[model samples]
Target: MRREDDHPKEHCAIFGIFGNRRAAWYTFLGLYAQQHRGEESAGIASSNGKEIRHHKSMGLVSEVFDESSLDALKGHLAIGHCRYSTTGSSLAKNAQPIIVDYSRGTVAIGHNGNITNAEILRAQLEAHGAIFQTTTDSEIVIHLMAKPTYNNRIEGLKGALKRLEGAYSLVLMWEDELVGVRDPYGFRPLSIGKIRNAYVLASETCAFDLIGAKFVREVAPGEIVIINKNGLKSIKPFPEPKRKAYCIFEHVYFARPDSLVFGENVHNVRKRLGKQLAIEHPVEADIVIPIPDSGNSAAIGYSSESGIPQERGMIRNHYVGRTFIQPHQFIRDLAVKIKLNSVGDALKGKRIVVVDDSIVRGTTSKMRMRSIRESGAKEIHLRVSGPPHKHPCFYGIDFPSKDELIASKRSVEEIRKFLGVDSIGYLSLEGLLGAVSFDKKNYCTACYSGDYPVRFDENVSKFATER
Candidate 1:
């Protein structure tokens, strides 16, 4: 079993469709494109203008939905999600889209990112006689909507949503209507698309391609889109104009290169970032090898700038499950060993430079370094494609506390000692902006620089205790 300290990664891709019989199928395709956002579980809910039904399970999209299950959820409107647990344990109850029944209507909701204030809200709700059925913060929405003080359910949701203080992109299904909302800072991505006569709401533009939908605009920060037979209505929940703090990591490591976010192409941005990294940290090496998947783009840039050939020296076993069989400590170390192996012939006697997206705790990097050394590499130079994470991520990422962050209190030389590498380099702060086409003034880099766009009291640590 994995250690308890290895907190389950929590993130999800949310999709919604309205005014289409093929919505359930289309949402399935959307979830496929966004599968990288989460991997622990997946689910879908559909509405036929009268009743809402759903199917959710613990697995990837394909494993969760077979031919029969997909067919069973036919509706003119639908919303889907792929889950990664954060707040609650990794049980079936934590899966999305979470469907609940109330006197007003049946609401199925899918959300991305964490709500920092969930525990306080939960306690307040319970004190007022609200009975909760799930430990998920997502369920808090049901209680918020069930309040009788509001004129209607939508207004009640808006009130509850306004009181929230952290990152979230919500997709709510109310009877026949499918609604999508983005937090004021747009810490998460959500977009609107069109598939012939239908409207689609998804976490990324790549989902549009999967469902044969034409890419439309993103859901503006603090904006909400309501879709039903009457058509789409937009709502802006935040007051005044606030600068957006879109997560910069979304372009750096999280999103698929094929996707378009905030009118910027992900693949192109990554290539540019690679070029910038090379300009900032020039290095001489026999070959530059990416750490696979996330590291590919930055590696290519490092290769082009250093005039070194880009070689696939390290190969990842795509079949490896997130959790490995580690019956003992030695076996656990071996589990990390088999996850990635070096291309022996490519690395023999060669001075290698390794590039990866980021190093969370340095354990994985140390293990990978050892793997390369075992393959008979003469020299190993490590290059990180992103800035050092000096602070914990309060939004959604599973980063460790400040004490656990190597960069938080250590210098480059110290980090090299911790990871056992000959030479180490990281992309510069400017290199971060060089990776994206958008203006630096708008993006969020709080995790890297400790300059949070939204100021919260230091007591914010108490939020975790509440959850």
Candidate 2:
């Protein structure tokens, strides 16, 4: 199967609660906290010692669950997921917190990242009488755990996790306990948190704060933490190599600015990236304007460093979902305009520096620049808060195909000409890593350098090659 390289890896968010009778509510709140990580669909599964109950549907967390629905779910151990598809096509059947019933028992798994060997593993399982339930790699883990070789459940979990490759931070729920496992490379983010007498597992620390769960510590790279009535027990040294390379994009755009991952404060890291970008490619402009939401944080950083006043030059229509099948060119063109509009009054006759999170297809940026120009901005200087995406990401990001990526083929000057901007600059790779204060060996800059942390098969390798 060909990889969908153009599709942004909708790095999912996973949240789980152990020991709380109100597990569903806390799981719902935790998933809501991580909604920025993904928004295509949501699901929650709860287990009350005897059986597992779940409610899953396509849509945002708010749209999927309400007061009545949460009331019906009963359990002390639960897991919730906010997902964006990466491995397979977007379909209702692929929505997660995938529940499975097998010879061992019932289990529900909510996963936060992609698996490179998912197809191979799925094929093996299918040959051995494992009936596939969903298109996600997450279900593979459930099948693996159900294998009869291991002496105990924890050993089964470790054995299963060891078989997988690529990015993953998974939370699996059984009848009595919630288990959290991070991949050996720690390619994705997972942490442990606590509220009064309860333990939590989540993709980001921000999810902990949402439910007033105190940040205890991160679930170490290859560690498995089991949360049950007894307390938190970590199966240490579960099998890690040397350094940890959490996906750097978690800080760049996918995460909510308030969230913290890999010990880096996301908002501050973005601001630092913008400040450094200004230093690398300073532009003379009257006001600094952000591309809204994602760019706002970095724009402030740019304004602070460049001594430019930060202004609201563009406004986004949050009503638009991530994907739309307009079918016709005219409708697709109109969708872009409807998704975002420049504040004509604020932009008029100003020397503007437009700061944005990152430019992928460049079509969106091109349209935004044209809108700002139409709004009468005298001079538009473009600044990106992250390095130009020179290669595609296989871990879990929805970067465009190599040919569609502006940076993949065009130089800075050519990109400026194409975007109709006076000057264009992207945050340097060093500056981006520095902004996040990441150890060089522990951050994946694969999209910028084509140096993936994990090995891949021939087909998967094609997804990362520069066109």
Model number with the top lDDT: 1
Give the per-residue lDDT digits (tens) of candidate 1, residues 348-454: 98999898888877877888888898898899889887888898877777667788887898898899988878898888878797667667878889878997776
In candidate 1 the C-alpha lDDT for residue 357 amounts to 82
For model 2, residues 59-118, the per-residue Cα lDDT tens digits are 889999999999889988899998876434566777888988766688888887777788
TM-score of each: 0.94, 0.93
Tally clashing residue pairs in candidate 2: 5
Model 1 residue-pair collision total? 0
lDDT of 1: 0.82
RMSD of 1: 2.2
